[model samples]
Target: MCDFTVAVFRPDDDRLEDAVELLESLGATPVPDPMLAVEPTGASPRDDADYTILTSKTGAELVAGAYPGTDSDGVADGGARTDRWNPGEATLCAVGPKTADALRERGYDPEIVPQEYTSSGLVAALEDRVDGARVEVARSDHGSPVLLEGLEAAGAYVHETVLYRLVRPEGSGDSTELAAAGGLDVACFTSSLTVTNWLEAADERGVRDAALEGLSNATVGVIGEPTGETAVAAGIDVDLVASEATFETLATETVELAAPTYYE
Candidate 1:
């Protein structure tokens, strides 16, 4: 029996580690070759507002410092503001358990709402709460305006703070890492950017066809609907989608889909 190989495109080592551990436990091997690199934006802090909206774990980590007693996992210090709107109930909201646990460790019991775990879900959840409140959105420097835009459209006072930036991984001379992913049994794309970066890297390495072919035979898993759409746009058929928009769920579903082939 051949060892099932899975390609993970997330650039965060911590995330990559968690995915790899999950896949391995399910009888799959992870091929580590990230396509994106997370860079901090160094944006100055804005005024403390009524509400703080965090979309990504990266953003959570950056602003985690601002909310002292907030651990790396998004936990807030006891007695700190705890009415913040955490999309995934703090767990699946930002990055993964670590971020959620961090928030809890600090002292916050995030308001978890049952819904799709994504920026859109967060927006929908905030519609009623932020209609006339001042909300501050903290995100990556290159983050999208989707969340903030939606908030304002819903009559909320939205202020944005850039916390980080995402760029192509540095020191990677070429897209060789992507080219080598051609033989994997499954390719997991966590974000729309991951899809773009993967394809871009493939094109740069002149292995577009190879990458596509590799994807064709294997299952393509996406973290969210938008990411799934991005994969479809890239001409890769997504076979599985994580129930929740989180890397952990994405990897779990990917492993489950490919289990028959690799796991007994």
Candidate 2:
């Protein structure tokens, strides 16, 4: 019955809301809130592209703007002329189930979901098979170019779309203030951007030290090795790295790290 306090820095999202619901179900109280929002940087998919590579659900959702049913979930308008978009014969590569679910919701049947669930994993899964193919990669505005470079090195022409950008809402960096109030037990990071955004917010709010001190004492859980690196770069102490790079896994690891009583 020891409900631990936690923090999440992803864009406000239904899937994230679902993950938080799962965490709450595990007896955690998320702090500074998980309602952080990521804004799309006006990138659109090409209907004529030979292949579509979705690294995250965010990429899938951004690409969905071209589809009929999922237009509302797509990146905002004026960014791309997706009206006549048709994904004819284009192969879809989803990084994981979450991305696949988003693709499916938008009437796409993902042809690839890398077993490893990471950028390197995706490349390993498709590189050998996509020789001479033109692949479009959709991801966050600040997504690493390793996937692009890797695909190109493997002889696949890669196109990248900036699906979204993480930005703090006006006056949003009260994380340190929240943690200083005490009771926050877990600090959760879902992506490199989350780590960057949290640190930026903390610094902007002039409470970087307090936030760092507070989080240093908390069980810090990151979604993957990259996220762990980002957290460390942001001066966050990492105590847990999810075996898999997924929010679901992050939540599970969080439970084991911050509230083992309910982990099972």
Output the number of the lDDT-best candidate.
2
Candidates' C-alpha lDDT? 0.65, 0.73
**Which ranges in model 2 have alpha carbons more than 4 Å from their true place?**
66-84, 260-264
Deviation of model 1 at 118, angstroms: 0.8
TM-score of each: 0.79, 0.87
Residue ranges of candidate 1 with Cα displaced over 4 Å: 65-98, 106-114, 171-182, 262-264
| Displacement of the residue 100 alpha carbon in candidate 1, Å | 3.4
**Highest-scoring model, TM-score:** 2
Model 1, 100-195: lDDT tens digits are: 565566454444442656667777777777788777766766555677788798898877766556776854313334434656787788888878
